[model samples]
Structures are given as C-alpha cells and as structure tokens.
Target: MNRRCITGTLGPGLLVLSLASGAVVRAEPVFSPAATDSCVSAAYASSPGLSGHGVLDCIGRAAAACMMTPDGDTTVGMMVCLDGELGYWNARLTAAFAERLADAEAQDAELRTLGSAAASIEESLRAMQQAWLSFRDASCLYEQAQWMGGTGGGPATLACHLHETARQALKLEGWWAQ
Candidate 1:
C-alpha cells in the first residue's frame, strides 16, 4: 500500500477524498482540487434546466484536466487555474442578473411594496452583488493574513476567493433558475 499521504493525481481537488484516505484531512492543504466554478452558465444562462449541482458537475472534466496538467501540481499554478474558472462563472452570473432585469422590465411591472417600483428589486440585487464582492475581497484578505505572511497564505487566499466567488455564482445561478 502506498503510504504516502500525498500521492499522484487522484482527481481535480487538492485533497483527494476517496477510497485511499478514509478521512479528508482538514489541514492537508490541497494542491489541485477540482475547479470550484461550474462552467454551465456560459451555455445556459438564465435557464431553469440546470441547477447549482449541475454547475458543479459541469466543470468536472476541466477539473480533472487541471489535475493532470503540470499546473495542478503547484499551489501557485492551481490558484491561477481556479481564478480562470472563476471568470467563467462570474460571466454567467452577470448574464443571469441582466436576464432577470430584462424580464422584470418586460412583464413584471408591479411595485415591490406600495409606491416603490419593482425596479427597486434590480437596485437591491445590484447593491447585494457589490456588497458581496467587497465582502469576498475583505474576507480573503483576512484569511491571507491569518495563514501567515506567505507559506500558506497565498494558496489559502486564492482558495477563499475561488470558493466564495463560485458560491456567489451558484447563488446567482439559483436566481437565474427562478
């Protein structure tokens, strides 16, 4: 049995959660985990056929590719790969928000409350997205600081950004689903 805790490319993610290791170690420091963002929105933006889970699976192939590639072996390279994937998801989110706004303008003209135009919902979404952007940035900054100046800080910080952005993308996808 290969006693080496960190072996060859098991999959996309840094830490392999599988038959090899019964427990996914919390501090194992994944080198090349699965890509966080689902590349689905690029194709099915603002559509209801796909769910958040679908998005997660949609990127599975790319994640596996990343695992095989040289970049998957290093923390820095993995960060770059994740950042690239995040871009795709972010684009989908933007498209989703725009699609929602367009729908609102065309049919749902009812006021949100009493005299407040339903357009306020658009404003609310815009505000919420901006706030989330700020929060993700700030929180990652804190995470980097906490993980020390460098050793693990860069990877952790990038991972935080990737995870949070992907999460937000999923939320936007959920909105798109609606």
Candidate 2:
C-alpha cells in the first residue's frame, strides 16, 4: 500500500486535503465535521475512505448518518448512532485537555501543582468541560421543545447535540498546542 500526506493552505489557513475522487475534500477544524465530500472519517466505521479523517470528519458523519436514515428508519435509532459518535468525540476532547495540561506543567519547575491559586488546572478544565456538557444538554432540550408538535423536534435536538459536541472538541484541540 502507498500512503502519503499532503499539506497545503486553503485560503491562507492551513488545510489537509484528502485523496480525491473528482472533488477536493479538506478536513475542517475539530468540532466542525468537514462539510466537503462524502466518505467521512474512517473512525466512524462508516465511510470507507480514510482520506480526511479528523474530529471534524467524525461529527460530519454523525450529521450525515442521522440525516440519511432510510425513509422508514426511526429517528430515535439515528439519534442513538449519533450519540455513540458524540461519545468518541468527548473522549478525544478529554485527551486533548490532558495533553495540554501535561505540557504546561512540564514547562515550569515550580508549577508542580499543575496550577496556581484556587485549584489545579486539571480541576478547572474538568469543571469547564462539565459546564459545556450541561449547556449543550439544556440548549438541545430547548431546541427540541421549541419544535415540539412537529416532525422537526427530534432532528433539531440531535443536530444541536452533534454541533455542540463538535464545537467543544474543536476548542479542546486548540488548547493542545502539540
């Protein structure tokens, strides 16, 4: 097998383009779910193409998976599938936080506590992450309720979750400078 990585700039910002098939597919930042071509991240166990796999790819797949459910397919089943993908992204976010925290601690000899005053950076990060989860849940609940009595409620809630989780994951990746 032959594998190669191609790196370039997309409109001045860094971009990683995947192998082609008549279209240019670029991986988006974490939490975005690349909105380009099909064949999302192979991590989703869905797309056969591993071209632009990333956090963004995972989320994109969640969106597609839910939206592409067959005509007779249940929305609840789609939501369940998306929830599993969200779980994977949450784990990635946690890993990013841990990696960044370790790097920060290693740079300062006196910073053995991982943070200064009040609480450890780890605790702070965990708290902030918890807050994000709470907010995502509450907001999605509202989205669903707003669409109650309509066919859009379930999808509205699922989309809210997928987008929020992906957005947070993107933030965590930014923190991981490495």
Candidate 3:
C-alpha cells in the first residue's frame, strides 16, 4: 500500500491533498451556518422525549459535509465549520441554562414552603455552572495541547468546544425537563 500527502497553497489557509492512486482531492466551501443550525434544530424537534442521541448524532454532520466540499477541506475551513456548530450549541446552552435556572429557583421555593432543610437548588445550580465553565475551558485547552502547536490544534480545540457546549446544553435541558 502506498500513501502520500500533498501540500500546496491553493489560497490563504487552504490545504490540498493527493491520493496514492494519482487522484487529487480538493476541499470546497460547503460550511453553511444556516444549514448547521437547521440540522441541529431539526434534530431537537424530531427527537423523542428525553432521547439525546438524535441531537448528539447531528453534531458533526455539517462539519463532515463541509470537509467534503471543494473549498472546505482545509484546517481553517474545518475550524469555521466547527465554530458554526459551536455557536448553535452555545445558543442552546444559554437557553437551556436560563430555563433550568428558573426551574431550580421555583423548585427551591417549593422546598422552602415544605419546610425542608435541603440545600438551595438555585444556588447549587449556579455553583455547578461556574465549575462546569472552568472544566470546559481546561479540558479544551488540554485537547489543544495534545496537538503540540501543530495546525491541528485549532480544529481540535474548536471540536472540544463544540462537544462540551453541546453536552452542557443537553444536560441543562434534561434537568429542566425532569
């Protein structure tokens, strides 16, 4: 088996590759933020109650589609595609957090009426969200560090951000729903 990697500047921040079969493959611009958002939204809309796999499965669909495009195969293109998904997840996370926080506050108030001595749900949620932010930042930085200053670092970090944000969004949504 023979494998070869072709490197040439098609444009700024673009990378091209060639196969061992003398076939050349180029990346095109296929990443669309609207498309990504639509895919994510559809995933959520179609998901059966409490089933998260549907949304999770949609995470990299747009990025994979982008990578297959003629102008979107480069590292920078991948980062941009990942960022689009990250933006979607970040929005979801924000909405979910707000809803969850409100629910927690209500639940805490109910507990107070019952004269229960349990910890405040709203306060606990705030603390947990703060801790999760630190964890997500540290974990993503660690993922980038694994690339050791290589061009892959940027995409890896963005992917990490996407994953963490999506997970947090789902977690918050679940908490609110339950």
Candidate 4:
C-alpha cells in the first residue's frame, strides 16, 4: 500500500468530519462541489433507476474497497484486509439507512409500525455512531502511539481510517437526502 496516498486522501476526510461534528471547535471545513459531483456521477453513471438506496449501496461498496488492504498474509494485514473492525460500521449504517427508507415509504396500517421501527432503528444508529466514534478515536490514538517516533505507520493507518470514515459519511449523506 502506498502510505502517501493513504495519508493525503484520509487526512482531509478526518478533518472534514471533525469539523462537521463540531469536534474541531474552530474553522469549519468546506466540502468542494467535486465531492457531491462525484457521488451524483457515480449514482447515475451506471444505473438511471438508482434511488437513495442505490446510492447507499454504491457508498458501501466504495467503503469496503477502501478498507481492504493489499496484503492479507499476516495477522494485522489479514484484519485490515478483511475489514474485521469495520463490520459494525457497515451493519449499523446499513440498518439505519434501511429503517429510515422503510419508514419514509410506510403508509397507513404499515405506518403504525413506522414510529416503533424508526425509534428502534434510530437507537441502533445512535449506538452505532457512538461505537464508530470510539473506534475512530482509539484507532487514531493507537496509530499515533505506534508511530510517535516515526512517520511510517501513521499515514497508512490514518488513510485507512479516513477512507472508511468518508465512505460512511457519503452513505449517510445519501440517506439524509432520502
């Protein structure tokens, strides 16, 4: 894996997310039109009938691809390549998006279940978000600890984390649109 590519791509994403979450407490980062344009282009480029769900799927696939490591031989490499740490990220995001979409589409009798379902789904999403936040912070800390004396591993780790984070953010954006 090219460490520089990972660092460059991931740093901005982390910074953007931090700014969006108010975690930065200072200057807010602006998302360029290119970001939305790429998402829109990807959403409609292949399938015209694509809905918000389709966009979510695209985002998930993209996230999975970014999370994958080229080497899967060693333990750490295997974990990264398998994205074992990201399973919860994928599950929670998928469930949250699915429940929201379903609630939006529900009508009448089915609508009765909407409130309860949405509540449950919202709770799950919230918990998932919290867990993901913890994971992100811990991962960053671990990377820093490992690379405190050098710059070798920090960039790669940060890049991987950022890629997954951005992937999730893109999926969430699509869900919000719906």
Best by lDDT: 3
Badly placed stretches (over 4 Å) of model 2 are 1-58, 69-74, 101-109, 112-119, 149-151, 175-178
In model 4, the worst 10-residue window by lDDT is 24-33
Best-to-worst order by TM-score is 3, 1, 2, 4
The Cα local distance difference test for each model comes to 0.59, 0.57, 0.79, 0.47
Could you give candidate 1's per-residue lDDT for residues 1-178 as a string of tens digits? 7544543444453444344546452222223333333345443564456543555545434444564576464665555555555565567677777876676554445564356644466666678988999999999999999977866787677667766776676676563355
Question: In model 2, which residue pairs have backbone atoms overlapping below 3 Å?
Answer: 31-166, 33-56
The model with the greater lDDT, 2 or 4, is 2
Clashing pairs in 3: 27-70, 27-71, 27-72, 28-69, 28-70, 28-71, 28-72, 29-71
- Could you tell me every candidate's TM-score relative to the true structure? 0.57, 0.51, 0.72, 0.36
**lDDT per residue, candidate 4, 83-152, as tens digits?**
4334534554566567655654553336455554434444555677778778877876777678665644
Q: What C-alpha lDDT does candidate 2 achieve relative to the native structure?
A: 0.57
Per-residue C-alpha lDDT of model 2 across residues 1-178, encoded as one tens digit per residue: 5655565657632344545433354433222223322333334344234222353544546445544544213454445545555665667667877876776555443466556444455566668878988999999999999986677787678777867876676566662223
* Per-residue lDDT over 1-178 for candidate 3, one digit per residue giving the tens place of the 0 to 100 score: 9788776767744456767777564544645556556766786677657665666666667776776776566777777778777887888899999998999999999999999999999999999999999999999999999999999999999999988888888778782255
